[model samples]
Structures are given as C-alpha cells and as structure tokens.
Target chain A: MTDINFKKIIRIGLIVYFAAIALFTVGTLSRLKDGSVFGLPKFLVYGAVVLVLTVCVLLYVLHLQKRLKSGKDAFGLRVLRTIHKYRFLIEQLVTRDFKIKYKRSVLGVFWSFLNPLLMMIVQYVVFSYLLNFRGTVEHYALYLLCGIVIWNGFNDCSTQSMRSIIGNAHLITKVYVPKYIYPVTKVLSASINVLLSMVPLLLVTVIYGLIATPKLYLSFAVLLLPLALLLLLVFCIGIGFILSSLMVFFHDIEFLWTVFSTIWMYATPIIYSLEMFESRAPWLITVMQFNPMYHYINFVRSIVLYRTAPTFLEMGITALISFGTFAVGLLIFKKCQDKFVLYL
Target chain B: MNEERKLMISVQDVTMTFRREEDRSGSLKETVTKLLSRKLKFSTFTALHDVSFDVYNGDVLGIIGRNGAGKSTILKIISGIMKPTKGNIIRNGNIVPMLELGSGFDFDLSGRENIFLNGAILGYEKPYLFSKYEEIVDFSELRDFIDVPLRNYSSGMIMRLAFSIAAVVEPEILIVDEILAVGDENFQKKSRARMMELMGGGTTVLFVSHDMNQIREMCNRVIWLDGGTIRMQGETKEVCDAYRI
Candidate 1:
C-alpha cells in the first residue's frame, strides 16, 4: 500500500543540490580570496562536502529513474502518461499560453521583434553615447544586444515560472496531469519569445557587417546559437522549477527575485565588459566568470559577434552548469508539487 | 441485481488530513521568532478517517453526507487529483473524473477550443476528441455559439458543454461530483438519461450528491459519510430512510 514518494525524495535531492552549489561557490571564492591555488586544504574541505552532496543527488536521481523505468507506482505511472502518452496536452498548453500572451494586444507578437530592437537603440544611446562605453568595447551594439536577449531569456522565464505553479492551481487540482508540466510550459512559451527576438539579433549582426568578414563556411558558428539556446532554455527551466516551487512556500521570493535579477544583470558582463573591471576589480571579473549567464552570453557572442567557436572547455562547463540546475530544479519541483494543493 | 460483477475500484482505509493554518502570524519577523522559540501554531482537520469502500463493475455508488463530511474529498482521492495521506487505491481500468464541472475551461477560449482543452484535460487524446467534436456540440446544444468565448455564455450553457463532453467520453470509470445540480430541469433530465446510458454500457460510477430522491432512483447502494467517517451504508432506500430518521 505504501509506495516511495518520488516527489518528496526528489525535492530533498534538490535541497541538497542547492546546498552543494552554495558550498561550492563559497569554497571556490575562499580559494581565490586566499590567493592560493584550488589545492588549498580549505578548498579541499569544501570540495569534499560539495562532492558528497552532488553524489547524493546523482544517486537519488538514478534511483528514481530506475523506479520510473520499472513502472512501479500508480501516481508515477499516471504522471508519466500525462507527460509522454498525452504529449498533445503539453503542446496544447504551450499554444494556449502563446496565444493568450498576444491576445487583444495591438502590436501582437511583433513586439517580440520590436522590443529588442527598441531596447538596443535606447541602450546604445545611453551606454554607447552617454557613458562612451563604445570607446572601450568593440561593436557595443551587438554586445549589448546579445546580453539583453540572453538576460531576457533568463529573466522572463524565471519571472513567469515563479508564478506558473501557483497561478495554475485551479487546473492542477482539477486534472491528474503531471504537475511539473506547468513550469515546462512556461519555459516553452518564454523560449518562443526568445526565438522571435533572435531575428533582431541577426539584423544587428547584418548591420554591423560581422557576417561578411568571415567565409560562408566560417559562418557556421552562427549555427551554434541553437545549441547555446538549448543550453540556456534547459537552464531556465531548471531555475524556473526551483523558483516556482519555492515561491509557493515562501511568498517573498517573487519580490526578492526582481531585486536579485537587477543585481544579477549588473553582476554579469551585460551592459559593461570585463575590461571595465580589469585593473580596478579583478575579483569582480573572477566572480563574473562564475556567473552562468556570463558563460552563455559570451559563448553565443563568440559565434555571432566574434566569429569564433566557443572553446570545448567552456562548452563543457556551461553544459554542466545548465544540466546541474535543471536536475536540481526538477527535484525541487517534484518535492514541492504534491504539497502544492495544501499551499495553494 | 447480478451479485457476480467484478471489482471496478477498491478503496481501502484512505485518510486525508488537511492542515489548517489556525491563528497563524504571517510576518517573516514573527516566523523567525516562532522558529527560535518553536511555537509555530496550526491545526489539522482530518477530512477523511479510515474510509474504506469498493465499487462493483457497472454499479452506481451514490455518496451522501453533510457539507464537511469528506464526500468531495473521497471523490478527489479516488480520481488521483489529490493523494490521500494514508490509504491504498486499486483502480482496475481507465477513469475519467468530472470532479468539478467546467474545470479547465478557459473563459477567453471559444467553446469549441474548450471542448478540446477540457477533453484533453480529462485525458482524452486529440483524435478521439476530434471524432466526438460534433456529437459533443450537438449534445450540449451550443451549435449557435460554440465559436464565441465561453465567458459570454451563462453558467447553464457552460454546464451543458461540460456535461456533454463528460458524457461523450465513455470512460470505463466515471467519478462525478455534484455537477447535476446545475442547468434547468430539461438539462438535468438529459444528464440522468446519459448516466443511465453509461450504466447500461458497464461503466462503474461513483457520484456525490445531496439529493435524496435522485439518489434513491439512480443508486442501488448508498453510503453516508459524516465527519470523515462512514456512518451508514446499505441499499439506497434503506440508507435514505435511516439518514432521514
């Protein structure tokens, strides 16, 4: 009669993962502040803790995955049915969210195009002209454009997904679908928004004459944008799962996230460059390097703006960060989902 | 009544405890204080306690209770919408639960779109809904305005659309809430006829309602729930008279 609560166990895995990330960040930062190599005893202590935490989470994920494969639970089976066999429902939900977003609006989905273009102009005027950032940064328009779009993908998805679980309470309790699908649907809708905005990104590239400088075959770097987008989308969904689930328990996260995003936007090399902080605050540059958005934005900018492939090392690290967040996010969402009926 | 029907659903000792935030302080500051002192306060309302029941194949089991009697909670648990705090539920076949009439119906979406949306929400595949689209519309009698947004329709019209889809789906097991208490007399009659048709096709039904007369007519057996416990259960007429006394 009693079965394993995959939801509860997975959520605990998420919390452990969160602790691991925080501890790993602190450990890395401590090593940097001590001006010692990562081999310092302090780094090892932190590293061991983080390693154990990650292993625990990984083990749990594997365990649940095995159970899922064996088709053991009624609730789990029903949820799987909703996600895979009833895949049409998820598609319909995405379409419904997309359509509702543009309903009754005058400019409609074209705003996706005009929004980044207008923001690029305004940002170019302020940062390029007022601050004279162009003197320090090459092709400042394209740089700022890439940052805005990349940051927007994270920003919009996080914000929307924070509300996705609680906002759809009416439907979640009424239907027996997988509760996690709501956050996935939000991520998909946000991905579509980002997809449309990519048009202006290309237009900016054309205006700047970056495409012609390279051979046609060399332009293949541009194709790397999809891989980068896929990476970021999964990352957002991961973070979305975490934020949306936690927001149900604590009402203040939504408010806190707005402030966090503003700080995060500045923390990443979005409007400014690593050059600006080089001599004055090398530590800030080091911290920015640790930011996931820095890796993602810089990776795409390498392809689209700089006409170079992202280094393999950089690609692997970014993948780890995104996939790590997604795994943790999913764990937390499943954990918090069953109790959602009580909270909502 | 044939006594040899197979078991359609087996519910055993399902217990649901609802944690009610009673006299709780909302401020984060107070929450921190409570955390330090360990005086956080709440009360648990047991909605269903040790509830056990079963549904035979093709039987209409009517559930009756006062409002806070865990009647609706039982329906939700059996439908897998909300997992019970404690129990075992064995479902034999595919189930379609119309737990809340007009649930998952978006107000801004057209009636036709809602049919697909609601049908999908009820676990119907797209192709099946497409096959039943015209029949559902015809049954709901909304041909004149299926394209219009559902928000424009009156509550009765929405119920008509909802009932039509639920009826057309032909689920093996149907868990219905108090959906029949809506619309006019004509629609209620139509809904009853549809229920009879489902019963004829060997579809087991578990329904929750307060109408004594209707329960007597539609149900062969009835169970009375009170304060999250099964107070009485027997043949419909016998249980109804005992409940009245």
Candidate 2:
C-alpha cells in the first residue's frame, strides 16, 4: 500500500515539475523572439543542466528510499529535523538579541527604521556634495537608501554572527544546543532590522516619485523586493556560518572582518554608481560583477530604482551565489562544530 | 538490582585530549611569526583517559573527583556538550543538562523573558514552558519581579529563578554539575527536596559534586575519577568510603 502511494506521489511530482519546466521553456522561447531574453543561449544551457541534475538527484533519492526509512536519515533531512526541534530556541534567541540591542536605548525599535535613513543621509552628503555624484543617478536618495539597506543587513548579519559562537560561550560550555543555531539566529535578528529599514526605502521612493518630473510610478516590480531581501538573508546566513566557525579557532577573524567589510563596502556600488568605475577602470566592473553583494544590491536596485522586474538571469545568479555560499558555509560549520568546545 | 534493567547510556573507552600551546597565538601574524622563528610549542593534556561506564535505567550515577580529575569533562561528554576524542556514547533519551543554571540567560531581558529563554535553551518547547510558566514563577517567588530586568536581580534571586525553571522540567536524563546549593537556606532545602523528588521519580541522573555526603545520600552508583582516569567504580557507599580515606 505504501509502495503504491510512494510511486503515485513521485509520478504526480514529476508531472508537475516537467510542466513547470515546459512553461518556463515556452516563456524563454517567446522572449527569445523579442530578443529580450538576456543571454538566451547561456540561460537555456543552465536550465537544461539544472533539469538533468535535479532528475539525477530524484533518482538517487528514490534508490535510497529503503535505506532512508530503515533509520539513518540523509544529511538534509537530519538538518531539517534539527532545525524543527530547535525552532523555539532560535525564536527565543532572536528575541533576546532584539531586546538586548534596544534595551537601554531611548529610541528602542524605532532605530531599525531610522538607522538606514541616517546612513543614507551621511553617504548622500559625502558622495553627492563632496564627490559630485548628485546628478549621476535618477532618484539618487532612493538609490542610496536601497544600497545602504541591503549592505547594512549583510554587514550587520555577518559581523554579529561571526561573534555569535564566542559571544555565547557561557551557553556553549554548559549546554547541548546545536552550535549552528547561534549564527542562524544572528542572521535572522539582523534581517529584522533590514526588513524594517525597507519602510524608509519605499517611503523615499514614493515621496521622490511625487516630486520628480516624470513621476516615478510604483511598479508591480516592487513586489519582488522581498524576494531579493530573502536571497540576501540566505547569503548572509551562509557567510555567518563560515565566519562564526572560523572565529572559534582564530580570534583574528574579528579584526580582519572589520577591514574586510570596509573594503567590501567600497567594492559594492553603493554610494558610487558603476558608471563611475566603468569610465576609469572598466576591469573593476567585471570584478564587481563577481562580488555576490553586487548582484544582490543590483537585484534590489532593479526592482526599486529601475522600477522593473529582475530578469531570470539576475534571479538565477543571486540564487546560485546564495545557495552556493550556504552549502559551503554549512559544510565548514558542520566540520568544525565538534571542535568548537575545545577551542572555546 | 535487576539484571534485566535497560541501559540508559553506555559510554565506551572515551578519551579527551587537549593540546595546550606554550605561547598562545591569537592572530595569524603571531602564528606566522612563531612558525617562522620555530617557537611554536604545545603540551598535551588528557581530560579523560579510556573511560568506560554504563548508566542503567533510573540509576542515579554520581561522579566525584578533585579539581582537574575529569569529573566535569565526563559529564560534559555525556551531556553532548563536548565530543569525545576517542570513544562512543549512546544515549537513549532526551537530556536536560543543568551544568550551570541560568548560563543562557540574558541580563538585559526581564525575569519573565529569561524563563522562556532559559527553558528553550534547555530544550523545552514553548507550549510546555507556557503551561509551566506560572508554576515556575510561583516556585521562584519572583512573580512580583518577573517583569524586572535580570541585570537588577540579586545573585540568589537569579539562582532561585534558574533552579525553579530547571526543576519544573521532567527530563529522561538529568545531568547536573555542582549546582545543588542555591538561594537561601529555605530555598536550598526546597531545591534539594525537588532534586530528591526527581531522583525518586525514576529519572536516570548523572551528578557531579564535591560533597561526598550528597553523593552518598543521592546516588545508587558512583565513579571516582583520579587524574583523568577512573580510579574506582562501585556502589555509592563503597566508592565514597574509599574516596574519604
């Protein structure tokens, strides 16, 4: 009876999966006629490779179904189980981080909204007034705000998570909670601030839209802002895992990260436009393209500043980078976690 | 004792070694310089050496040793806080390790918030904590001050709160390390009674304490550690008698 049910489920799942793939292929083909499918050939190749890889994975899972049921779980399943078991712990820790951060502050949670605005203003003055980037980008305030919000989320998440394991030494030495919970929760709490800061970004966009000449209309593309932020959050969590694990062994990572993030902030086209770098050093733009933050910030900019839907290629790149980093970070974290107690 | 009793935990040949650096390097630069100058040196210290033991169902096992004799290390290994360098431990049930009470509590959080946070850290689900919330507060006698931040809490009050939250949970295996003394005289008596109640309720326990009297009173089995190795293992009375001499 269970065998039949499993076969039936797999059949339905494959049908749905193939149907979605067919629909996407047709959409890509339609876009191809208009010559608007960005790098169509490459996109199709990646799509085909992804399809084949997923099919192979499905087959492998089916082959291992018997072993999976007998007691030993797959790695991903074990991770999910661990996550499910400790979800409330994660929630409590995140709450603790939020409370502790704003405990003594008079402003309290309002700072999450105000922090990005203040940062945008500081950068706007430095770049626009001093560097004469005032007229460079349309809706420059919104542009700066968008970049700052995403960059700050990444910065805060990575920096705070890097310290999470060491910071929670009192707990680590005494308990058996999964070590990964620390970095994961830090990313989650930091993302809360990122989420709050988006309100100001939207407000600026609307206020600027009312005052601008060609009235910047709020596009349906604005709906994709959350998707972009989710991708950024995933990327941050991955980086958090890698950094926190490393920080346990090497105390120097903290100082190194300070210098690293500052350099990283400059590499990302936040205050300065990519056009500025394109003119003087064309090669820098290529290097910037490789930077995951560049893709993430650009993804946000495409939605809010450009007022357009991100192309599938852009979405694909962000997903790849985010999940790829996540995979690597998880691997490093899992490998090092058992040794953390010794180092701590 | 029944020979057919089930094993709650079986620890086999566990060994833990710590490599201590003569001059600890906290940075890459220092490490690189030490490597270049041939000054990097390390000394090995074994915290546990080929330790093996079994905890039967509902057996209250006590571990006693002087400082650096591996009592805490063994407890930590069994509680799953630290991985053993060599050996395996098979645990049959959930562990609530009260190695240090209120270790996961945040001082900035309110007394009420710390209860949920500490409970969660000890692996209690939200609904469980919610049901026990009022009871924990009542037991801690901190209902009036539940909303107050823990930073303002006196050390005894914090210990009372920690013990109350910990005591309410019914764990399959309870691993505690030298934290029995808590709060004032009245509260300590209450906490000791609570501990006895949990022990009497047939929960397997691994306890580490310096007080031989406490071990003799509480534990059915005892393992006396000496210099990272098990020097003796037998009935609590037998082992405690030997250690006292």
DockQ of 2: 0.81
The CAPRI classification for model 2 reads as: high
Q: What is the TM-score of chain A alone in each candidate?
A: 0.75, 0.81
Query: Candidate 2, A74: how far from true, in Å?
Result: 3.5
Runs in model 2 lying further than 4 Å from the true structure? A1-33, A36-72
Q: List the residue pairs that clash in candidate 2.
A: none
Clashing residue pairs in candidate 1, if any? none
- DockQ scores for all predicted structures: 0.46, 0.81
* lDDT digits (tens) for residues B1-245 of candidate 1: 89698898999999999886655554456667887987876799999999998898888899998999999888878888788999989999888887777778888888988898788778787778899999999989999999998889998999899888878867878887764545789888888787667755667888788878778877888999999999999899888998988
Tens-place lDDT digits, model 2, residues B1-245: 98798889999999999888896776788888999999999999999999999999989999998999998888899989898989999999899997778898888889999999999999998888999999999999989999999999999999999999999979989887864769999999999899878877889988888888788888999999999999999998899989999
> Candidate 1's residue-wise lDDT over A1-344, tens digit each?
12345667578858865764664363235232342245565555656766896788687577667767787555544554445555777777788778778877899999899888888899999998898998898778888999998888789888988899888888877777778788888889888999999998887787667454332222556756777898999999999999888877777888888999999888888889999878998888667767999999998888777766566467789999999999999888888777887777
